[model samples]
Target: MTTGPSGSVLVLTNPDDVTTDLVLRILAERRVPVVRLDPGTDLHAGAALTAAYGTGGQRGTLRTASRELDLTLVRSVWTRRPSPFDGPPELDGQERRFAASQALWGVGGILASLSGAHYVNHPWNNRAAEYKPAQLATARHSGLSVPDTLITNDPRQAREFAALHAGAVVYKPLWNTPYAVDGRAQQVWVREVRPHEITAAVAACPHLFQATVEKAFDVRLTAVGNRLSAARIDSPDLDWRQRQSLMECTPIAVPDPVARAVCAYLTAFRLTFGAFDFAVTPAGDWYFLECNPNGQWAWQPGPITESIAHAIADQLQKGPEL
Candidate 1:
């Protein structure tokens, strides 16, 4: 597990993801040796009875971690993905819960044994960054403008906020939980909210209603260490995800103030990586929306992916000066 003259990175991720594939490729190109391991397999139990099912979707297994795969030598770990477990149907619901609890407890124990290693963005840091309200407040505190926002479970309050904002509010899910029952994908969009729709939207959860700025364009800022890259994303539709094909992204210079704010946000969150989304108003104002710590960057257009890969490698190899 010792790192060679060339530093090593352990990418703990699922086998079937574009993120892992892209990272592996980039690391190889830079001659940064990496080992990919499934967290589930690495944390498996030896004496525990386990059952494997299904071919490709998911598999439940009974296995154990080897002594050699100990956490001490792990110089850096990218907690990209962890596999899901499905136990045997024959086991009662309570039995399944007991087994799952045991697995998690074991995994926790293993993690507790580790001396700290540099995580590109640790899971806990990512979790803390996921809260939109926190992101907005942090951004504003760091000298970035942020749109007025409201989060409440009350339909009446939401409707009132929408009306006060001249129906120029947008709704976004607090967390990324995209689900589909069948093959079709469920659509979620960010657009001008109607006061009348507030009643129905409140039934789901506390809605995050915000004043929708009149955006001339959108920006995705990928911050790796102190280095940052801003891309201007222009789309025909209100939500960029909807008209992705029509969207054109180009490298743009981030204002010094904005770049400094981003660096502050990163330091505040103790994160080495972050993907920040901003709403650029027609008035030339950039309003901070949210930051995703474990955000998707490989799919970012053009040299963005390459830039991030190099940035990450630089930090690992040069001892975090950047």
Candidate 2:
């Protein structure tokens, strides 16, 4: 691929990210300049950055193993999941911590300072949108239906919430963090929780409990700019992710109200891309579950995946609307 005279699309994601690979291929076909960098592992290894600031604003050059990107010439940036910054192995203890911190604020700050470049979903916005409480409140305010929910560390409140829902409550982790038991990695999948399960141990941290919606199926609605792709997922398990082999996905049209509400939610978060999950009841009501600001969409059925990739590529090629 060759750089175009216009500007480059700077992608910050690890090499193993297949989702990004799809978009990169489309960008290549369009002959748009592309600069892919994974700051975490690439910094000292094969990537270097030099930025300067003056009355004209920030300007710099980022040199990776295969490309040199002019910061001022960046049209847009895709803040995909990049690995955490790592210092050289030779440094340990406070030295390692110091080096990592410097790199984060230095290199990370420079990339974020690109003057005219638009971020698909800015890192700051992504971080803010990750809060479940904020999500529920924003979803409700945006005119989307949300389930009765509670976020608390008090066991009594948890028990009361579960009781009010007639033991039809589901427990969800606030954040999906990596865990392992006896050397085996495990995920805390969503599951039905009875009042008895609410113990004093819950006081250790805040837990999210919600009235389970009697759903006929689930929807994974992916939004890229103004484009939306809705995929209906059918699965027997409470968490569809637990049974990928048994799950089925098909394209579905978005209801007019749902579409408007989703757009409102995206605008509320100032995001250009989102992966929203919704539970549709037997009565055909769509209940907002949560939205992943930088969630995965490539795993959807072929057509949906292809459409998302094309939409993202189009946005990157066009940059942001002035």
Candidate 3:
């Protein structure tokens, strides 16, 4: 195998991710060595990795179609939205399952174990931060105001909570998953819930309910390293995502307290990057909604998008100090 360059940046994400594309472009301009690999699809399609560890410490090499990477020389890793591992088409269901599991434990573990590589929010940390309950609690602990919330599988508790909020609560899914209706893609958007709507079916699964905030607008704060880029989102819909085309996005300065709290939240999760959502009240209170550890920032309007991309590239280029 040919030797790859030292101090390479390893980017793990799907090919179609425009956000990754922007950062890659900046890295290219800066002449930084980057090896972009989608472990899910590339592993079985010409990509290869070999790792070994003893008293001498870990050593490995990963090869893609056009670039070879010295695993030990990797300076940083971006664990973005990589696809799931898949086996060859010829493999039967059981065999495919086995192969995928092996790839996940073997390949995934090695990538996670890269020594001295700065992670823009490691995959393990991302998984931990994905839990909404943990997010709400962490936000609260970090001195950020979080809406009064409830998570329950009991119908009685659900009804009581809604009644307690005077039926001004909104129901949000505990997590987002691939959902469709009659072949059309569907999303579970936050919607108002009434006490009378609480049914026995709620007992089937845990549900998240929060008292709706009286908001003037919303904020999408993208954090890379110590830098933050925030945008004010104004929309008529309760969920801004539902009417993104109708929404207006303008650059906004993050409140000092909110910025400090966000940094604390990232430190709490051991994350170097996070995309935080906040509901800003007319009275100037910012209510913590959620934080997407590996959220998209390139979609933001104006210079905020490029600013965020530059910040991300800067982190990857610098990596971690050995």
Candidates' RMSD to native: 7.1, 2.1, 3.1
Q: List the residue pairs that clash in candidate 3.
A: none
Query: lDDT scores for all predictions?
Result: 0.72, 0.91, 0.90
Q: lDDT by residue for model 3 over 71-138, one digit each (tens)?
A: 98898999988988887566889999899899999999999999889998799999999999999999
Which residue segments of model 3 deviate by more than 4 Å?
1-6
What is the C-alpha lDDT profile of model 1 across 110-165, one tens digit per residue? 43233445777676777788888888888888888888899998888899999999
- Model 2 pairs in collision: none
Q: For residues 125-235, what per-residue lDDT tens digits would candidate 2 score against the true structure?
A: 998999999999999999999999999999999999999997769999999999999999999999999999889999999999999999999999999987999999999
lDDT of 1 at 11: 68
- C-alpha TM-score for every candidate: 0.82, 0.96, 0.96
